[model samples]
Target: MEHLAYFDCPTGVAGDMCLGALVDAGLPVDVLHQQLSGLPSEVRFTLAVQPVQRQGQRATQVLVHPQGEQPHHRHWAEIRTWLAEAHLPPAVQNWSQGIFQRLAQTEGRVHGMPPEQVGFHEVGAVDAIVDIVGTCIGLHYFNITKIYCSPLPLGSGTVKTAHGIMAVPTPAVLQLCQQRQVPIYDNGIDRELVTPTGAAIVTTLAQGFGRPPALKLERVGWGAGGRELPLANILRLWLGSPPASALTEPVVLLETQVDDMSPQGLAYACERLREGGALDVWIQAITMKKGRQGVLLQVLCHPELVAPCEELLLQETTTLGVRRQWQERRLLPRRLVTVMTDWGEVAVKVAEYTGRRVNVQPEYEDCARIARTHGLPWKQVHQQVLHRFWQDMGQES
Candidate 1:
């Protein structure tokens, strides 16, 4: 029963489209409105969801009609204050804050100003507020634990903005995707598809971007873009659980036997493998041919990293040949959650299966660093973090 959502954005994605798709996927409008009611804004607006035809297919369009105030510029401080005063759910508040933070930081980089000082013009308006906040509320309501997205469509042509007409894939959008390593491409539509608001939300929240993952396909939500295009201009959302039979992908296993590499060199090679994107690396004692003792260096990596990982083994070890194999791995859905303790903040690795949490481990690096800094035993720091996380979880339950 693990829940996941995938955005299939062939046309592109925007804040409104995301909200619309979520609404279309069965998130109640009343609940969305209730949660968004606390936003510290004087402007009044209505979220209208209606059926629309995109190209030849049906989709949902969410239109915002705001009264009393038009789009206006807002500083980072102003938006931060609004979020803080809104009294959102803790998860919603934290997630929404991170999206806006990325937006401001991207804007700051594009405009040559500090992130705190950057002003959001087009994205600071009421509609943008509704889109971002509504999206968060919808996600919270659904209790979605995993998000995957298709390669984003970055349309071309100029777009009018508060700053003036800027290039397609506006500076803020470009910077956001580039910084996050989110993939983007042009489909030659000659229109602006991905807006800063859309980019910020997706880049901030998406765990991976590519083709949709293997899902059970429970419900599909199509979010419509504002413009009509030759191609279907809609964002399709897929919601489901991981396929019951498989939650695994093939990974490359690179192994080498080393007899002469120094301990310092072996450690550095392991470090290099990790830095080069090896999923894991380990050394094992073994007997080579002719009863010669050797260390077996094993590297596990994504298929894409096989070459670099193999090269490191060849260069860093005395082994003449590196063995490669493809191995399938089944993994639990996991993420890092930080727990604030007296010593400091420690990240707990949380793993879930069938929508139930199965294991939670405090990150050793955080515990060790805190132990050294506070002159406490590492075990004590670890125990304190574990205790704090369970206490918080208990209260939430």
Candidate 2:
């Protein structure tokens, strides 16, 4: 089964809430402690999980207390140094770095500075580190490959920050949402619901945003906020495999017979179709009614993009009419991993089924660029990448 985690943010989300829900879901506290042990000795914090009632419903509240005075401001480079020294898994390290990087970028843009020079105030603290890095470790422990979150309820009014009191949906949060294209809405509450850390985590790791996918019920964990609010003030996490029915999604298939279009135009049309969000586009040579060799251009895309894709076909190709139909697609659960090869870092596309990895292939574009740059055969580079990938997987296993 494909393992997935869906974050239900009815009240809102924060770093601590995400971590608490993940820990409460099934991650062992001891394992979390062990994984976090790699952090520098200067950073000390204790994770306390307490049972609380939010709006009369039981929830897990995670409070992270720093052991001593810590720097409230730090540059992105400093944080990266700590992560580089840690002996965490490559995946965890990458995930943690990415989240922080997104935060840094947002902060930098808001404060008019480069990302590496942007000083993190609330996010630079030891507790914030634990919340982010700890969350990554927890996700690794549960082998969570995909995450989905609901549209955030960005509160109204003002929120106190390092830069003094600012409007709700803080600058950092707004930048994060815009950069990642995360959906956000104000539910009329006048307080900060989505924190910077929370925005960074979700924007960085979440693959999709909307209602939970169709999945068989497995486990549920409720993570509570700091104080009681009008709403539940809890984040619900659902862990489960996608339902059998979700294996395929309805998509639109557009096809048209192209007997007169030139090969050049066909190539350009394929590129435009892809650029216009077509899932896949190709041509099949066929013999039309009068023994004339013709080409059939097929475009596959989301059902919603049918009109735009069809328009592009008509605008770019010499097709008078386009036939469209809704089709179901069964897609494998896949993720990309970058592996270090002799040439450089190569991204490997991995497709998994039934909880087991079924296919691993190097990204063709990366291999082609490497081959062209190094004056080597693309096939040789491909083989070398596969070899390195297997070697790395073997070592990790």
Candidate 3:
């Protein structure tokens, strides 16, 4: 069971946009308001869902408005206290802390004060507060287990704000981004592509960076950015499920046969490739026309490393030339874990979540050591290790 949150931030992202995305993803607006009321503050704000169009496509926009009284700006500490007391799930609580910290650092840098000395300006006001808190509430409402986004679209040039004209993507925006690595960039929108509150919220809540992961897409939610543009100002929300399998980011392969190189030196070169995150490396025995037998070395890596690896080949071995190709590959979702086994501790790579690991593979190095010590078949020892992990998980459950 998984939900995919896609950021259509080619225009930039904001807290309002994110909240709108969640609302579009099925989080109820009234439930969001109900949670906000649990906070200690007496402030009043309203959440409005409005229709917005992006690139000729209609999407929903979330608008936060101060319903009656004039809104006042509060400092970071005061706002943090209210949020800490706000009713939220654990993930949402930490998510809120990260958001506020990013917001403060941005505001501080914008005002030319040290990040710690910076306080919230308009962001601390009632409506913006609603935007940030409601985003957290909506996150829980949708039961989104994980959040991910694309590189943020930070517009180029300068933007005029309440504090006067600051650079687009603003000092606050940069500060918030620095707090966490949420991929962001100025892609020529020329207006503020990402806002301080938006950057903080997205960067903090999102789990990892890259193109949206492969998943079972359940629904598509569109969040309006409120401001109109000649183009669309809406954020796209894609809800997905785990696929039986999925295509991943493309990697360009550069390979060639190297027969004359010494095995030790070639092994060293392969180490260097793996260190730089190469996908795979192997060598094959082949015969040349002259009838001399040698090992043919091949290397595979992402396209970006072509130059670096090419340099390594030039300096590390006698490969005169390498061939490059555009190739496609597929991979299963993977993770790591250490399981308790008889040979002490063994790292296990498990596949298929059948409420329990259907296949648990013992780390080969650990198995080898255990087999050598106990004079047991390495394969047999490895099987026992998995049996132990399953027994333990069952007892614990």
| Tens-digit per-residue lDDT, 276-374, candidate 2 | 898999899999988999998999986546768888999999888999775556777787999898878999998777767778999999999999999
Cα lDDT of model 1 by residue, 1-397, tens digit: 5688888888888998898899889988889888888887664788788989988888888988887766588888988988988868988898889999989888888989999998888788888888998888888888888877777889898999888889998888888777655667878788898999998888888866666677788988888888899898888889888775447554668898878878999999999999998899999999988998889899998655666787888887788998877555688778788899987678999887776778889999999899889899999998888889999974452
Candidate 3 C-alpha lDDT tens digits along 1-397: 5555656676788878888887887877778778778766556766678776677887788877775765466778877777788777776677777788767766766677775666676787777777887788876666777776677777868877667787776877776665554555555566777887787777776754457767677887788886776668877777765565443443456666666777789889889888877778777788866788876667776544556766676778787887766454555555457777756878777665424445556688988998999899988988888788777653541
The top-ranked prediction according to lDDT is: 2
Q: Select the stronger candidate by TM-score from 2 and 3.
A: 2
Give me the candidate number with maximum TM-score: 1
Give per-model TM-scores: 0.69, 0.69, 0.68
> Any residue pairs clashing in model 2, and if so which?
none
State which candidate, 1 or 3, has the greater TM-score. Answer: 1
TM-score of 1: 0.69
- lDDT of the candidates, in the order given: 0.84, 0.85, 0.71
Candidate 2: minimum summed lDDT over ten consecutive residues — where?
243-252
